[model samples]
Target: MSETYYLHLNVSRFELSLNGSLGQSVNITNGSDPNAANIYPDISYSLLTVLLLIMIATVAGNGIVLIAFCASRRLKTPFNYYICNLALADFLVGIIAMPGFIVYNLFNEVWPAGTALCTIWMYFDWHMTFESAINLAAVSLDRYWSVRWPVSYKRHTSVKRTILILLATWLYMHIAFFPGYLYDRIVNVYGEHDCFWDLVMNRRFCTAVAVLGYYIPLSVMVFCNWSIGSMVVKRTNATAQDPDVAKKYAEGETRLTLAKDKARRQRQPLITLAMITVCAVICWAPWVIYFTIAPHYPTALPDILITVGYWMCYLNSTINPYLYIATSDDFRGAIRDLFCRRSGQTLSGAFSMIISAAPKRTSLETSVRRAS
Candidate 1:
């Protein structure tokens, strides 16, 4: 039972809501006047159920990635450090964004959470997303530097520099959003005054941030990946030309083939990153296009597209751990340890048995070179 309001639109009048009812109506009338309504009968439970599963998987998966990283000392390294940040961003988004989105879906897209929650949701949603994008871009730069100039990379890419970069990324996002949070207010155009991230002041702010926070960083990541990938390809091709590079050495040989094997060992991580990039593009491209174009034209398709993009983006969190395990040997080992410890496997005992038995197998060349 909600009150209905008739809207007058220059020569056409439309009923926006039905009286004594909490929902809008689809029975639009246009006899010398037209009215718009929220067809209440159109609510779909199927979609709601799907959203629930997505939320659960997304949050749980990302949560595990974060927890595993935090608890595992063996996983600690400069490379894993940035990955840890990326996981944090995605995990935070899952916690902050997914729950609210599920609620909104359950409630028929009607936001009952007052202005504060709405603001917080918008902030968290945008912040964590931006953080993920920039962190990935930072990671690309790190990998590029590490491979492109290994010696110099070691000199500059210390733990301190990594931390500073991560901190700066967060700080920059916060500062950029400060103005919008201060002056913006969600306008409830749908009658129930559902709080949302409204286009305040001008859509220019949104456009600006979207480019700076997402597009620009994404571009940077692409560039870095391209450069590093090219270097890897060139090095690998050159190695193919080097008769010794591909020759199988005796297991007892005291020479390190670490450099020669670097690309092969790193293939999985590169594949994982490539997959992530594809997912990001698929998930966010539509939303980015919608946001960029929506200000000029408002339509149901744009809104629907944006919703689709949002869920797709949300899926990233859960997929990261699986991707890591599938891509990186180190990450898989960490997962193995985590599972082993939990499954009645001897706490320190199981790990000790595994560790004391045989060290990770390395070619004789690699072992000797690293020792030297």
Candidate 2:
């Protein structure tokens, strides 16, 4: 049986372990706690099963998205590159971050890994998670502009520009986040069990990075979606009342039908982006609210915030690939083709086939599905 130390677990962006009992400061030094006598029995390995299942699902879903992106030329759209990057971030979280985190919680929140690994996980967890949110925001903004200005978008949109934008996001996020994080991890030395997260000490700096990484991006997603939504509504109203457009469609005008089809295509990507925004808001809002409010009432908040709320954020990562891919026929077809190729049920020669079979896209990548 594991030792019951009656400590409330505090899982945040940086910190992911049990601290002292509420209102009681747990000593982080070499010595054991003076008051380890409370017998709270709820801290158990019961969560391991749930957590592990989620971790597996998270990995498998994102893995398929990555594999599909690589294998299918259909998914080579411009903004979809951003989706690919988001999948990479989420995949890292599922593969690299979640396993160690599960081990941390499994062993009563005392980290099972070395201090070095713990510090790395601490950074990877926040950075990748934040990176995903920002990527979605960037895609939403890009899609909005493309929808708003279809004529100019054709001239400007390209795979190279998409790659450049993704690079810029990675650079900007690292610059905004890593320097301060590196400073804290280097300066504040702690014990084997202690993964030092000086969020309380570095509140302003942490909160600013959080804003830059998450909250601002969140606002941008909302604004972009709203703008796109309003434009689509106006266009729909204008088209519905126009007798000329209706008559052309009725009279089998090939050009008019093609134009209408193109317009329908433009609206589809926004729908996908909007769906992602809804999922992000639902999954992230709890963790975001909890983290912002928890520091103030560290002693008073419920234990479930760390367990349930944090998992909700991770759920955001798990849900992203499926949500985005499921909506797009290209992604769906790509994923279907991928599984069919692997339908032989053999790992033998699979890697070679994947490597050798990957095709390069030579055409200019347009804006999202409906953008062209």
Candidate 3:
């Protein structure tokens, strides 16, 4: 007997038949409404507008951070190196991930791109996301070292070393995410062209990815920030009790004044770290938790919850640069100076004002330069 397959498509349903002799059939109903798979037209239009705005803001905000870092030589310290890289990762997310995501959402969760494009899209999606997470952890560790060790932090963390660490983080992320890519390329059996992850089917791999990309880095960041906070409190108390420290600074009139100034400087970096940690948790934790648990109860999770999780994670990229601007006078001043020069303002005057107001170089930087 000859074997044959038949495909059937109708306005309200889809069907497939294998082996005309054996008569195996599968039917999928398209439901009573033609627009069932699509979001409500008005809602779709509104969401499209909102997502477009988010995409634009993500790109513009991260672009400004990259530009500000590049334009200001003073911002080129080892710590800001991590910030620069984080900005770059977020910039890539804005450019590579956001637009496709917008299309995906607009199309009602359908993947318009073919398999090859889908694979590439998924790779970049994880790559940029993991890069941002690891970069945030790196920033937390850098701040911790600076606050805890101060003098030796500079000597140990040189520009070359920082570059090496950044490269390693990027490399590690690629390696960590390689298994998912490999699975998609080799083991994916789904004939339907879709860009979304099938978390229910790929439970083990997704769990591994979540642990490596989210939980591990989040733990590290929390630990480092906690240690840094403790150190800051101890240091502030010690400085408050030491009158000689005020005499040494020359700018401080009393121990209380010196302690307050030191606390202020220390608080800035901690605030920056805290914001990064909090945002990461707020944006990523829900997604991770949902994905990890949703695999076990696939039918119980709603489609809208998945969409919310994804967009919340995407919002992280949009919000990071603003955090830098809010917590960092240096970053703010750098952006201002960059804009001023771009708009044909006198650089000398702007630079002089910024330099006057800027804090002195950290002990880490001073030591790094001396060693160099």
TM-scores vs. true structure, each candidate: 0.75, 0.78, 0.78
In candidate 3, how many clashes are counted?
Answer: 0
TM-score of 3: 0.78
**Which ranges of candidate 2 are over 4 A from the true structure?**
1-46, 253-261, 344-372
Model 3: weakest 10-residue lDDT segment is 9-18
Q: On residues 1-372, what C-alpha lDDT tens digit does candidate 3 reach at each position?
A: 654555443322224233454444444335874323422223466777888899889889989999999889988888788888998998888888888887776655666577887777777777899999988888888888887888999678888899999998998787777777678667867644367667876777887887888888889999998888788788769977998875776764576676667768668867987988889888996688687778788877676787788888889999998998899888999998888777665667788899999999999999999999
Cand. 1 TM to true fold: 0.75
Please write out the lDDT profile of model 2 over residues 1-372, one tens digit for every residue. Answer: 334334343332122246333654454322364323332235555676788888988999999899899988878899779889999999999987788777766655666467879888988887887788888888988998798998788899899999999988888788768877887787766655665465665565767776787789899999999999998899889978998876677766787778878876766788789998999889988777766766566656676777676678788888888887778877888888888778755565787789789985544553343465
What is candidate 1's lDDT per residue for 46-145, written digit by digit as tens? Answer: 9867777776776777677777888888778777788788888887787788888777766656665666787788778877887777777877777877
Q: Each candidate: what lDDT?
A: 0.70, 0.78, 0.79
lDDT, candidate 1, residue 152? 99
